[model samples]
Target: MLEIKDLHAYYGKSHVLQGVNFEVGEGEIVSLLGRNGVGRSTTCKAIMGLVAPHGSVRFQGEDLGRLKSHQVARKGIGYVPEDRLIFSGLTTRENLQMGIQKMGAEALWTLDDAYRLFPRLQERADVKAEMLSGGEQQMLTMCRTLMGNPKLIMIDEPTEGLAPQIVTQVGDFLLEIAAKGISILLVEQRLSIAMRVSHRVYVMGHGQIVFEGTPADLEANEAVRKEWLEV
Candidate 1:
């Protein structure tokens, strides 16, 4: 559903993403896997129009490079950054309410669906977002983005630095998302989750995709793993 070709991004002359290329098929989970600073996050930002893209970003046959970030989102792409961006002052339910593109608009995701995915959100529905724990904040962020009812969701490091149990929960959540016919472009470093949940994986290095294969292909190729993935 999303295709990026020859994508490049710069931070005032510092080239971050260099001719990155990939595609996320409809209802498929594609993981962008690499270590820190290899430009995975920049790929998402460039696609989302947060960064000025120097190449083609096409979604559902529409060119997205000329669009602004909000415009890109309105095109049905949801982005959940690594940093959990939430309204600290708003109640959990209120924050979720803000993600609705339009009240009672027909969409695949809803507040009820979000609550079913993470029941803890319902338990803390009345609490301020700032008062939640780290994992809770992460869940809230993902759910709030879901409230937008995106056709595709690009999540950056959804399981970063959380407890193992929570990490597992996040993995299950990803599976559930894919089951709902939503394409997912997941930027994840955790190999187990990526391998388990992703239909295909791309290994990036020095701001370009160096490897692309199924989870089994990745597991069998120790050389590629050691070169681009293993730390």
Candidate 2:
């Protein structure tokens, strides 16, 4: 489980995340939704320790407020950024291989599992990552993190620029990941996919959580959507 309370982050004097609070239970999918500049991504960065954080960020009851990004990762928190970072020169197989732990405990996913989720990855397994399409790159990015065997994965915009069909594929993948017992914290711009895959949704505005509830509860609240989510 992961817990964040009164979480705040700053870029010099510019405050980004202000008093954000939320929790992601084991095997549950939680979506963080809001318009641009509402701090949804900042919350992910803060939780991943990519930025300096002030306030509590605990995972499995251990405090990680002061930990570095890599340290946080070592503690089982994987991050898949919106940029879909991958080694351009590396083959798809090599990129995926990079994520697998050569030692330590066993991971919950494998290249075979990733191939099953996204067959394109398997098709281009020996091809350089740079040769893959945008959707394929995103799939690779996510699978690479899964290779890390995280208890909780904070994914920022998994379906951002993909086609509608790819979006559906990614949404199904998120659901499958949860079914396999990996907690997901998805920062999504697409509310439809989020609602379909998540157990609950949290809407953020001006750097704070303005709404938190189940999908049905969110659907019934049009005012919240108008103010914090709808563009």
TM-score of each: 0.98, 0.97
Compared with the true structure, model 1 gives a TM-score of 0.98
Task: Provide the clash count, candidate 1.
Answer: 0
Q: In candidate 2, how many Å is residue 34 off?
A: 0.1
Candidate lDDT values, in order: 0.94, 0.92
lDDT of 2 by residue, 1-231 (tens): 899999999989999988999999999999999998889888999988888989999999999998999999999999999898899999999999999864444757988899999998999999999999999999999999999898899999989889999999999899899998999999999999998999999999999999999999999999998888887
TM-score of 2: 0.97
lDDT value for model 1: 0.94
List residue ranges in candidate 2 displaced over 4 A: 102-105
Residue 219 Cα positional deviation in candidate 1, in Å, after optimal superposition: 0.5
